[model samples]
Target: MKIKKILNNSAVVVKDRDGEKIVMGEGIGFQKRKNDPVNQAKIDKVFVMKDPSEHQKFEEILQLLPEEHIQVAEEIITYAEKEFGVMINEHIHVAFSDHLSFAIERLTNGISIKNALLDQIKILYVKEFEIGLWAKELIKEKLGVEIPEDEVGNIAMHMHTARMNAGNMQETIDITTTIQEITSIIENSLKINIVEDTMSYERLIIHLRFSVKSLLSNEKNHDYDEKMVNMIKENYKEAFACAQEVGHFFEEKYRIKYPEAELMYISMHIQRFYGRVIMS
Candidate 1:
C-alpha cells in the first residue's frame, strides 16, 4: 500500500497495488509522511470508491463537521461495524452518514429526539427499559456488581434509540409518531386497557410492531393511497386485538381493568420515535 493523502494524524487515505483505491485507517501512515511507503500491517481496510467525486464530496462534508461531531460519528461507525458487521465504506453513504452526524449532534445538544417521535420511541423505550432492567439483574446474579437501575435504563434507551433510528433523529421520530397516532385511535375506539405491571409492555410491543409495519409498507404513498387507508384500518384491527389480549391478560392475572392510560402513553412513544432497519 502507498499513501494517497493524509486526512489527519489519526486517519489517512491510501492506495492498494491495484491502484487508486481509497482506504481509511488510524495509523496507516503514522511513521511515513505524504508520498511515502505504507506497511501492509498498518493498513486497516481498503475500499473501492466507485465515485471519486462522491468521495471528495464526502470528505468535504467531514471537514465541515466539528471535532466532537467527528468523534461521535466515529463512535457510531465503529459500533455499527463491530456489532452489526457493516463495512466502514458502505456505512458512509450520504443518507446514513448524515443521519448519524445529525443524531449525535442532537444528543450532544441535549435535545431528546425521542420526544419528537412520541409513541414509537416510547414503546421501544419501555422495551429498552425492560431490557436494561433484565441486564442489570443478570449482571448482579452473575458478577454481583449490582448496576444502578438508572444507568441501565439510560444505556438501554440510547442503544435501542440508536438501533431504531439507524442513528438518524428526524426519520426515527417521524415513523414513531405516525405509528403512535394511528394506534392510539384504535385503542380508544376499541376501549381496551392495560397496566404497567400487568401485560402492558407486551401489548404495546405487539401494537407498535404491527403499526410500524403498516406504516412502512405504505409510507411513501401515505397521502394519496386509499388502499393505504384500508391497510391501516386492517392493521388497526390487529392492534386492537393485541389490546384486547392485554385486557384479557390483566383480567385473568389480577382481576382488574388496568386503565387505558398505560396503552395511551405507549402510543405516545410509538408516535414520536422513527427510523427503519437496514437489511443486510
Candidate 2:
C-alpha cells in the first residue's frame, strides 16, 4: 500500500482497501511521501477505525505519543485480544494509548489517580481485571515504569469500556455501579457470592445492563409470553420476590416502571443464579 502521509520515521497514514489506516514500524515511513509504497518488512502494525470521527481522534492522539510507548501499548492490546478472544474495537488503540500516556505522566510526576470502581471491577469483570493485571505487567516490562497498583484497575476499565462501548467514562462507571447494585441485591437475597465467571452470571449481567439502560433512557420493556411468565412467578416465588425488590429499587431511583413480564424474566434470571450457587 502507498503512504498517504508520514507521521514520523516509524509511522505513516496509508490509504488501503479498508479506507485510511495508520501504519507503524521501526522505519516504515522514513523518507516516505504521499503515494510512496509502504514497506511490508518494516511494518509493525496498522490501526483503523470505522468511525471517521474516531479515526481522526486516533491520528491526533497517535501523534502525541512516543513511538516506543505506542509500540508497547500495541503489544499489550494484541495480548489482550488473544487472551480474551474478543475483537476489541480499533478505538481502543487510540483511547487506551491516550490513557496510558496520561497515566504514565501522572506516575512520573509522583501523582496517582485512583479508580473508584476498582473493587467493583474486580468482582464484576474478573476476566477483564485479570487481563488488566497482565497489561500492567507488560507496561512495566516494556516501559520500565512501575505504576501504582490502582493503575491496573484503570487498565481494566479500558478493556471494559472497549467491550461495552458505553458512554463517556463517567457514564461507563455509572453503568458498572448500577449493574453491581442489581447483582448485590440478588446476591444478598440469595446470600451467596456470585460466580461472575459463569455463563449464567454473564447472562444476568447482560440482561441487567439492558434493563438499567432502558430505565435511564425512559424506554419501555415489551411484554413477553404471559403464560411462561405466570408459570415462572408461581413456581419461583422466592426468586420473584427478590426480583420485585430489585424492580422497586430501580423504580425508586430512576422512576422506571417495570412490567410484569420484565419482572418475571428478572426473577427467572435470578432463579438461575440462585440455582447455580446452590448446585456449586
Candidate 3:
C-alpha cells in the first residue's frame, strides 16, 4: 500500500486496492512521506472510515493522542467486541478514542470528574461495567494511568452505547439520568427507601429501562386492560400517583406521553417497593 498522508510517526493513511485506509502500528510512518510504500510487517491494524465526518474527526483526534494511547484504546475496544461476541458500532472507534484521550489528560492533571450515575450504571449495565473495569486495568498496565471508577463508569457507558448501536453519547447519558430521576421519583413519592441489591430494586430498574426504550421508540403497548388499569388507579392510589409523577417527568423531559400500560406496570412495581425497608 502507498502512503497518502502521515497522521503521525505511528499512523498513516494508505491507498490500497480497496480504498483509503488508516494504517496504525509502532513506527509505521517513521521517516515516511506521501507515496511511500507501507511495510506490511509493521502494520498492526487497518481501519476503513466510512462516514466522512467521522473519518475526519478520527484523524484529527489521533493526531492529538500518543501512539500508545491509541493502541491501548483500540485494545479495549477489541476486548469489548470479543467479550460481547459481536462487532460493535464503528462509531466507538472515534468516541472511545476521544473519551479516553480526554479522560487520561484530566486524570494526569489530578482533575477527576465524578460520574453521578455510576451506581445506576453498575446495576443497569452489569456486563458493560465489567468491560469498563477491564479497560481500567489495561489502561493502567499499558499507559501507567490510574483512572477512577467514575471514569470507568463513563467508559462503560460508551461500551453500552456501542453495543446497543446508540451512537450518540448524550443519548446514553440522558437515558441513565432519566433512570436515576425515575428511581428518585418513585422513592420520594412512595416515602420509602428502596433497598439496593434487592430483587424489587432490580425489577424496578429493568421496568424503567424498558419504559424509557418504549417511549423513545414511540412503541405503543396496546395490550392494556382498561378495566384492570382503572382498578389499579383506584385501589393503589398512592402507587398510581407516583407512576403519574413519573409520566409527568417523562413528558416534560422527552415530550412523549408515557403510555397507560407502562403506568400500570410502574405502579405495580412501586407498590412492591412501598412499605419496604432496608434489610440489614
Candidate 4:
C-alpha cells in the first residue's frame, strides 16, 4: 500500500489492493509523501467503504471534525460495527464526531445535559447501550474527562441511528420508546429479564420491532389459524398469558389491537425465550 494523500500527521489517504482507504495512527502520516510505501505496522485504523458517496462523506467528516475527536469516534465506530455485526452509516463519521466533540467541550466546561430517554434506551437497545457505556471509558481515557453516565444513552442513540439509517433522531426515539414499553410489559408480566445478548432475546427484539411497525402502519395481518392460536394458548399457558398481556398493554396505550394470531406467535417467541433462560 502507498500513501495517496495525507490528511494530517496522524492520518492519510492510502491506496490499497482493495481501493482507497483512509488509514489513521499515531504520527503515521508525518513526513509521508504521495506514492510512498506506507509502513503497515504504523497503521492503527482503516476506513474502507464500498460506496463512493459514503467515502466522499467520510473525507468530509475528517475535515469537519478535529483529528483527536475523529480518532476517538473511529474507535467507537469500529467497536460498534463489530459488536452490532452491521455496517453503520457513513454519516456517523460526522454525526458521532460532532456529538463527541460537543460532549467533550461541555464536560470540560462542567456543563451536562441529562438524556431524558436514558432508561428507555437501556431497556430497548440493550446491546447498543452496553457499547455506549464502553464508549464513556474510551472518552475518559483519551480526553481526561469523566462525562456523566447519562451521556452513554445519548451516544448509543447516535450509534443506533447510524445502524438503523434513520432519517431523523426522533424516529429512533419513538421506536425505542415503543419497544421499551412492550418489553417492559413482557418482563413485568412474565417476571423475567429477557436475558439480553441471547438468540431468544434477539428474536424477541426482532419480533417487537416488526410488531410495532405493523401496528403503526395499520398493516392488518388477515391470515391466521384459529386452531393454532388455541393450541398455543393451551400448551404454552404462561407464555400465552404474558403475550396476551403484551397485546392488551399495546391496546391500552396505542389503541391498536394485536390479532389473536399475532399474540399466538408472540407466545411462541416468549416460550422459546423461557426455554433458553431455564436451561441456562
Best by TM-score: 3
* lDDT tens readout by residue for model 2, 123-168: 6567778888887788888888897668888887788777635455
Best by lDDT: 3
lDDT at residue 133 of model 3 (Cα atoms): 95
In Å, residue 1's CA in model 3 sits off its true spot by 0.8
RMSD of 3: 2.1
Query: Which scores higher on TM-score, 1 or 2?
Result: 2
Relative to the true structure, candidate 1 has a C-alpha RMSD (angstroms) of 13.1
Give each model's clash number. Answer: 25, 0, 0, 0
lDDT of 4 by residue, 203-258 (tens): 77777777787777789774888998889978899899988888888888778787
Overall lDDT per candidate, in order of appearance: 0.48, 0.79, 0.87, 0.81
Give the per-residue lDDT of model 3 (tens digit) for 1-280: 8999999998898887898888888899999999999999999888887787877887887788877788888999989999999988888888889889889989999999989898789888899999999999999998899999999999999998898565477888888899999999887876788877888888888878877976797787748889999999998898899999999999998898888888999999888777454332
Q: Return the lDDT, model 1, position 40.
A: 63
Question: Model 1 over residues 72-94: C-alpha lDDT tens digits?
Answer: 44444455455544343443543
Cα deviation of 183, candidate 4, in Å = 12
Task: Please give the lDDT score for candidate 1.
Answer: 0.48
- Give me the displacement of residue 25 in model 3, in angstroms: 1.4
